[model samples]
Target: MSAVNDTSFNSAVFLLTGIPGKEDVHLWISIPFFLIYVISIVGNSVIILIIKTDPSLHVPMYIFLSMLAVTDIGLSMSTMPSTLGIFLFNYKEISLDACFAQLFFVHLFSFSESSVLLLMSFDRFIAICNPLRYASILTLPRIAKMGLVCALRSVALVFPLPFLLKRFPYCHTNVLSHSYCLYQEVMKQACSDITVNSIYGFAVKLLAVGLDSLLIFLSYVMILTTVLSVTSSTESIKALNTCVSHVCAILFYYLPDIGLSVIHRFGNSSSNLPQVVMGYIYLLIPPLMNPVVYSMKNKHLRSRLFKAFCK
Candidate 1:
């Protein structure tokens, strides 16, 4: 096997694959994926429009929601096209530059979503724990700043990944595990020692997604403790109710994520279906479900959504 470690590697391309052993079902598979892409795009778009158009939703909670919707849209768009192309049209050839671009945006939105969730957790924490200070604490400017920080942080961390991958010699098979590119998946195809790439990847994931998840969990624990201490049972339920949608959103995002991580790290490569299915779930479910959960849980938003559609 000849090692391609020169400048020519800058133009090297990779063939993205559908589920490894399930090519025959690619056409049928495309249907559900297309539907999911449509739903995720439409659902998040509606959430953004509703929030922007409604004066009643000009609060911190809704502002945080809008940020989440935007991130969801970004996430859906980053990977959906290539994913569908691979499954439906068998367009498997992806240029190295294009693959890197996809990797950056996919990871950018992923970490952005994690950051937004952390922000949402803080929003809930303030609303539940210190209602009197909620308005004063999370003003529109502050929320905007938080969103900017999340975006910048995600970009800064994920930006280094493609460059790092570019430096490695790709003498092995250039076929990726999924229809989309990922840091570890791409790294695994390298021929040389990837000690630096491995460590950096671990540190990035730990610092970004892992730390954010830990903080969100702690925020919820504090929120729960505070809610349970409330004197009235009705009040406790009401407080907890405010967090239910966020809790569901968190679970929807992280559970599939953890499952995919486990499968990638520990599962057998011979069985590709589980990993592919879970990858689709991880990528598609949150964006599709977030607006639905939020609309159903928040009466004000739901009523406004209904009135807007009825018009």
Candidate 2:
């Protein structure tokens, strides 16, 4: 494995679905993605507005919610334009630089979203376990700090991807599988082997993804124990229902991502469709489903949102 550290190496070219320069998947891809994008934006925007407009929602939970809406918008903005642009112009040629840019931003927003979720878990923990201290624990400054930390963490961890990719000379082969430059696919064309890249990627997942998830798990565990100690079945049921949407969102979003990662790593090519389905499920589903999940369950916020829409 020779090290091809050519900083100026050009990215290789690849065709979509084996058709050289054909945008045949444009309409089929664009229509669905566009619809989903609109839904995501609107749903998230409404949630944000409701949270902001309603004084009743000015709590830690809703602040985290507003952060989620912002993150969802950023998430959509990061990925949707290039995707929609590719389809609209029927132009499928993505340069190496552009591909790396997309990958970095995608991961950046993804990391932010995960961090926000972790903060939310802590929010719920404080509300449930130490209700008396909830306000002091999650003050405006604390919340602001959490958001800042997430933003900084995202930029810090994700900013390194493009730089690492730079270490490899893209001798050729820019054929990206799927609409974007999926990491494994681009890394596959490394003129120099990216064993370290694979390691870094795994380490990122372990630290950022794994540790964030572990904290969420612990927060929930404490919440569950506290709820159990209530001894009132009615209170337990009510608390359970209150967290239903968030719990479902967590399970649905992470379950598909975990599934896709396993299949992509271990399964053969015959699993491409499932992998593809899971890809959309991983990216689009959370943003799409999140607002709906919260709206359907969160009566106070949802009622305000509906009232705003009605007016």
Candidate that scores best on lDDT:
1
TM-score of each: 0.96, 0.90
Off by over 4 Å in 2: 1-8, 11-29, 86-89
Over 4 Å off in model 1, which ranges? 1-8
In the range 1-311, model 1's lDDT, one tens digit per residue, is 13354655656778887877778998998998899889889988988998998888899889889989998999999999899999889999888778888989988998899999999999999999999999999998888998898889998999999999887767566888788988888888887899999899989989898999999999999998998888899999988999999999999999998898889889998777888779888888999999999999999999998998999
Index of the highest-TM-score prediction: 1
Q: After the best TM-score superposition of candidate 1, give how far the Cα of residue 15 lies from its true spot, in angstroms.
A: 1.8
Pairs with steric clashes in candidate 2: 12-173, 12-174, 13-174
RMSD of each: 1.8, 3.3
Looking at model 1, report the run of 10 residues with the lowest lDDT sum.
1-10
